[model samples]
Target: MHLLVTGFEPFGNDQFNASGEAVRLVPDKADGHRITKAILPVSFQRSGEVLAALLQDHQPDALICVGEAGGRDEISLEVQGANVDDARIPDNDGAQPVKQSIVRGGEDYRPATLDPEIILKALHQAGHGAYLSEDAGRFVCNRIAYLAYGQKVPALFIHVPALRPEGQKATVGAETDNREAALKAQPRTSCTLPELAEALTVVLASLADQMK
Candidate 1:
């Protein structure tokens, strides 16, 4: 089986997105199935087009799209995508769509064809923080997830926090206290890019087993 995995580029104030970094680390093969990687733009207009083209080119048996979710400590296996685009900020291409439907005539929501429970369990067993999330948010992540599902693809989205560098607390979505002398005293809840890569490997293994 050929599997398609994708991640978004750096958007917002982030210098690097863990999703894209992790996707880049995924091996070329997982559980004897070929894996194809796509580094997608954070633009609403171009993301769909890029994903559609990859789908056409690869005809992957399953699709997994990954993105950064600030403030989330765990890897989120998003279960559903709403037909809405309510961006809190403009995308990479300066597109800030408000209350827009992802697909003009698509369903109000699209449930991921992949089994979220199984994926969540795999991540847990692999010692990665993970959970089943109902909302992929009304952002680019949701748009791609809903699009893939609507097109009858076994697809889902995974959200990861910004990777924690060597000696700094991941401040992606944290409040810093001026009173604290040591930044390390602030809780560090985010994982590294390598951890995210391992998490995806676990997910792919589970998917391969399920597809069989």
Candidate 2:
């Protein structure tokens, strides 16, 4: 079996993206399945384009796309993707799409083919902060999730937090200049990059068991 894992590059004022960093941390093999790592752009346009190409090239049995959601304190296993593209900030390409349909004449929304409940359970059993998220947001993560689900592929979108060591304050980059205030408002609830990598590995093992 083969699985394709993807993550997004850093965007905006973020110093580093945990998703991409974790993707790089995933081992080449998990439960006898080969893994392919891919880094996607933080653009609404290019992310989907690149994802489609990867699906074509790898033809993996499953796809797991990861992105950074700064405010979130836990790993979110998104259940569905909305057919909207409302960006709170401009993408890397300076494109801020609002009220835009991801696919013309497509369904309003699509649920991920993967079993989110199972994944959430596995993450929890592994002692990680994991939960099922109803919204994938109107960002590139949702766009790619919608695309992959539309292709009838078993896909999942995971939102991770910024890299932060245990017990230390997590300062997230904000679209506004009030970075310090934002950090103060949002508590320091995050995990290290290695911890996230372990969570992904557990996710893979759980998926492998489910497939069997």
Candidate 3:
């Protein structure tokens, strides 16, 4: 099976996104499945465009979109993607849509094709902190998932917790001092990049087994 796994770039006050870093660490292959990984922008409009292009180029059997969810201690296997774009803060391109429909005349909710319960069980057996989450939020992460659902492919969104401070390199810019400080000040549950990568590999393997 071929899998197209995606992660997001840094947004808001975050210096680094755990999802982007973790996807970089994920192996090229898992359980006889070919994996193509890409990092997406944190923009509502651009993220969807990029994801659409990737889907066209790769045309994978399954799609897995990963994003960083701060304050969440466990890896989240999202079950549904609401067709809403209510951003608490502006995205990377400074576009914040409030109560906007992702696709006009689309369904209010799109259920994920991947079974979160089965993936949750696999993660537990592998000793990873994971849970089934119904909400994917109304940010860019949810927007990508909502767009992906229209592609007629099996799609799932996984939310990874923040990365440990040591897991990401400090940004080298005097201008980003305040943003860096703010990121450090936020109280968040974090995990190592390796840990997230391992959990994602397990997820891919499990998904491949399910397809068989």
Model 2: which ten-residue window has the lowest total lDDT?
172-181
Best by lDDT: 3
| Candidate 1 vs candidate 2, TM-score winner | 2
**How many residue pairs clash per model?**
0, 0, 0
lDDT of each: 0.79, 0.79, 0.80
The C-alpha stretches of model 3 lying farther than 4 A from their native spots are 167-187
**Winner on lDDT (1 vs 3):** 3
User: Residue pairs in steric clash, candidate 2?
Assistant: none
TM-score of candidate 1 to 2 decimals: 0.88
Candidate 1 lDDT, tens digit per residue, 1-212? 98999998877665677789899999999878999999999889999999999999989999899987665677888788889887766788989888888878879988889998998888888899998878777778778878878776688788887565666444332211111222233333557788889999999999988788
Candidate 1 least-lDDT 10 residues: 173-182
lDDT of 3 by residue, 26-127 (tens): 999997789999999989888998998999999999999998776566898888888888776688899988889999989999888878888899999999
The all-Cα superposition gives candidate 2 an RMSD in Å to the true structure of 3.8
Whichever of 2 and 3 has more lDDT, that candidate is 3
RMSD of each: 5.5, 3.8, 5.2
